[model samples]
Target: MADVAAKERRILVAVDEGDESMHALSWCLSNLISENSKDALLLLYVKPPRAVYSTLDGTGYLFSSDIMAAMDRHGYDVAESVLEKAKRMCKDLHDVKVESIIEDGDPRDVICQMTQRLGVDVLVMGSRGYGLIKRAFLGSVSNHCAQNVKCPVLIVKKPKSTVANN
Candidate 1:
């Protein structure tokens, strides 16, 4: 078991437009903190790649078309909203600092790249996400990330909902 007295470790949490992301963020904020003091958290939101390609004539590539651009903007908006909620929850916790980043690409690749570039010590993310269709086709992002990143990855399963509500 890891010692609780260890120094603060950098944590990277992947966020997407989904309930799983929200649950993971909440769990990280509440559970992971510096033993000595506050620790920094980097939240990342990755947008799905757009359908664009290069021309056979070698003219240029068409990327981020009007529709894709709009979707990208929407993704940023969602990320910002999630960050705002996270900040609100952290108001009482002085030992945690949060930062948010939005990027566009394959989530697995982007997460691994960010982890390497940011020097992340731990990764906290949801085991399952809202991209069921994509997952069925492309495999789970968490799975790919777990296989690729060097650091330890924490995969949180969603809390089971009560049947009494129904």
Candidate 2:
């Protein structure tokens, strides 16, 4: 038999503050990664753009510079926390190389751009399980990426936990 070698792949996983994203990361670690394979896993966190409050608003309430600074700091903290949690999940996997990236923009656009820019083999993300109305209003990141990106997209949906009753 001819010798076969494992294909090297670059997998990108979009992570956020939600438990669904973390669950998707966990699922990817368990199911996609293989032992001794040359796979690079990238963790991406997209920060939303800062709100641009209009000065001419009728309310006439303006945010102080200190408050704006605090808001920016909070965003940074959240990004750091989320990335740290994702890194911890991949700590045990020695064979697969892992990296983290933080970008500012809409998650839907940023994710698609990153996948193309990085030339990822597959794009992995979690589904929020939004209802039709909610998804229509808020827009689904996973759905946008799934339709726009060139690579295969794997959207992992976290199953809701059930409670036992007598």
Candidate 3:
């Protein structure tokens, strides 16, 4: 019974293009996970769906091939870059397992859905560190997930020292 409780945990970390998310990944690896823990880390990146605009004719502005193509290209590039960085961070951890996950939709909804679907033991992410007014107006993803998910949620905030340097 003691061994089972100490067994590796299924940790899911939601990441994005921001440095905050990357920092959370590092925090998770160094703190929650260990060389001996054998924990599995799933790095999730949620991309917003492509823009769809309608004109007076009721046809999608997506008919603008050039504009649509550029938007799609940019989105794909960002998703790839962020996921790559997260994967690179885990390259040195020989004992830990890492999986890259990309989902398309509203980040708050997708993240919550995936957490429950994957049966994650803990959901870890970085807080935007927004002040009260900002979070209230913007409706924070971290806040929403914390309230909805069954698993424990860890919100890593970048330290003041690092913020000062940046």
Writing each residue's lDDT as its tens digit, candidate 2 over 2-55 gives 221265789999988878888888888888887666789999998766642222
The residue ranges of model 1 lying beyond 4 angstroms of the native Cα positions read: 1-6, 34-36, 52-68, 162-166
Question: Candidate 1 lDDT, tens digit per residue, 1-166?
Answer: 8754355677888877667776787777657764344577788877656431122214335444774567557666776886676566556656556777777777778889999999999998988753676555446889888999999999976777822110
TM-score of 3: 0.81
Query: What is the TM-score of candidate 2?
Result: 0.83
Global local distance difference test of model 3: 0.77
Deviation in Å, model 1, residue 123 alpha carbon: 0.3
Q: Provide the lDDT at 129 for model 1.
A: 59
| Reference-based lDDT, residue 116, model 1 | 91
Clash number for candidate 2: 0
| Candidate 3 ranges beyond 4 A from true positions | 1-6, 51-63, 129-138, 163-166
Clashing pairs in 2: none
1-166 per-residue lDDT for model 3 (tens digits): 4453256778999988777888888888788776666778899988765531122224555367886777677777888898898899888777668898988876778989999999899999989722344344436889899999999999998786685211
Deviation in angstroms for 107 in model 3?
0.5
Report lDDT (CA) for all predictions: 0.70, 0.80, 0.77
Q: Candidate 3: deviation at residue 127, Å?
A: 0.6
Local error of candidate 3 at residue 155 (angstroms): 0.3
